[model samples]
Target: MREDAPVWELEAATFDADHTQALAARLGEQLQAGDLLVLSGELGAGKTTFTQGLGTGMGVREGIISPTFVLVRIHPNLPDGPRSGGPDLVHVDAYRLGSAAEIDDIDLENTMDSSVTVVEWGEDRVEHLSDSRLEIALVRSEGAAVTPAGDFHHNDPKDAGGRDGVITDFDEDDDNEERLIRITAYGERWAGRKPDLSVD
Candidate 1:
């Protein structure tokens, strides 16, 4: 975190499908071609949800789903009208990878100049691909009590009914469910000291 780097934090009261769309709309306005976004979070942490918002904001194909099974999905803008500056979006999911080398086999770097490349589960391994990049990490707060008990398996004794059965109350400090998102700007395009923008 550079002292001068523009950064802002939002304490999302609740992390749900709508928050994902809002974040995307905010970020979509600030992005341009040749930018890379690295997203990291655990399963069901809403990485895909955020990307869905981004896709909607970027004017790429709508209904951008997680590429977990497809590996990569390219959302191209329709060329029907007078759209001159629209850029394609490339969504990649690297959860199945064992190492950085495996990610390289896909040659994602080559697409940066032509599209906004977003990699889900891409932190640690994909940052070097660009001189400028954005990293987003998401975490859920336990003190907030946002998770519904129904979401957990009732049969598990750890989650057994009574208040006494609860091992530990979900606290932001104690629970690992908090969501954190980091966006970094890299490359010559972002080297001019522009405001760190969320793009909304």
Candidate 2:
């Protein structure tokens, strides 16, 4: 929890989409304006699903869909006064970008100080924007099975410690996969306090 520590890690396991969203909501509770979360995971690894939970937790407008085709989507908070006085949500999808410069071209810094920016496929590309961002890497569990409809099925019972097994790399085209989410916090913004990823 040292402020100067290079990185601090927290891990969690999610059995299904509902569990994954619940976990994201917990993390969202700790978020505030000026926060940046860089997400990395294969397609169908629940990146967009997690963001949906985050937006809901933040009390932002609904319909938080993937920004893949559009590249970025902004969700303004309700005026009723949300956590930390209604910070906006800036969701970005960097999968189609060729370089970090393209991210800069989006003028995200203009809104960085007042919005919680969550970038998918932005691990290496978006780090330059903030030194105090969170890096979340998700993987599908090996025990995940395929359903008759050709979708992945994860029926493992919930594990309290969220440390069922080692997570490995996965295919981008995999569908309906269960995820093992690893979150790493960097810089003083997240020094002592860590997001609670435990499912509620």
Candidate 3:
């Protein structure tokens, strides 16, 4: 699902480690200061992987690992980009947040006006922090056990025959690989005089 405004979805059959880095790089190319990215998905859904790509693309300090225990990690940008104006990246993990009030203690909104903030597990809790945000939803699909080229045979031995080559399709089918990354430009630029986020 996608909209010219502010919501979309991305689907994939598998999420290898390489895809994580690639996603980040692609996002970095489109990012700028004051951008807020809110991520929502189940565990092992590649939230951190996406961030890694974004970090690399932005020329941020290497090793943009998840700040699970610490709740947040700040990656500073190098001074060699087109414009290095503020702190590079402010990465936040809102999964451990006990209550809505805890969000204020993080004090991320103060930085949103100048930095790119990526919040993991911040679906509903962090929307108040910024009116303008990019929401990403990732869904994993189950693909075929065997390939048309006959490389990977059927998973079920009973279905591995010669005459029929009986392919008892598993409930989980292999789907195409695609990342549904939705970018919503809200606020004034989107439809009003005063926008929540200003790209310029």
lDDT of 2: 0.77
User: How well is each residue in 30-98 modelled by candidate 1, as lDDT tens digits?
Assistant: 678888888866666667777877777677777688888888899886565223367888999988876
Winner by lDDT: 2
Q: In model 3, which runs have C-alpha deviations exceeding 4 angstroms?
A: 1-15, 81-87, 144-200
lDDT of 2 by residue, 71-142 (tens): 999999888745647689999999999899999999999999999999999977998888798888777777
- Among the numbered candidates, top TM-score falls to 2
What tens-digit string does per-residue lDDT give for candidate 3 at 148-170? 11121112323322322222332
Scanning candidate 1 in windows of ten residues, the lowest lDDT window is 148-157
TM-score of each model, paired residue for residue: 0.68, 0.80, 0.66
The residue ranges of model 1 lying beyond 4 angstroms of the native Cα positions read 1-15, 80-84, 144-200
Clashes of each: 29, 0, 12
Ordering by lDDT:
2, 1, 3
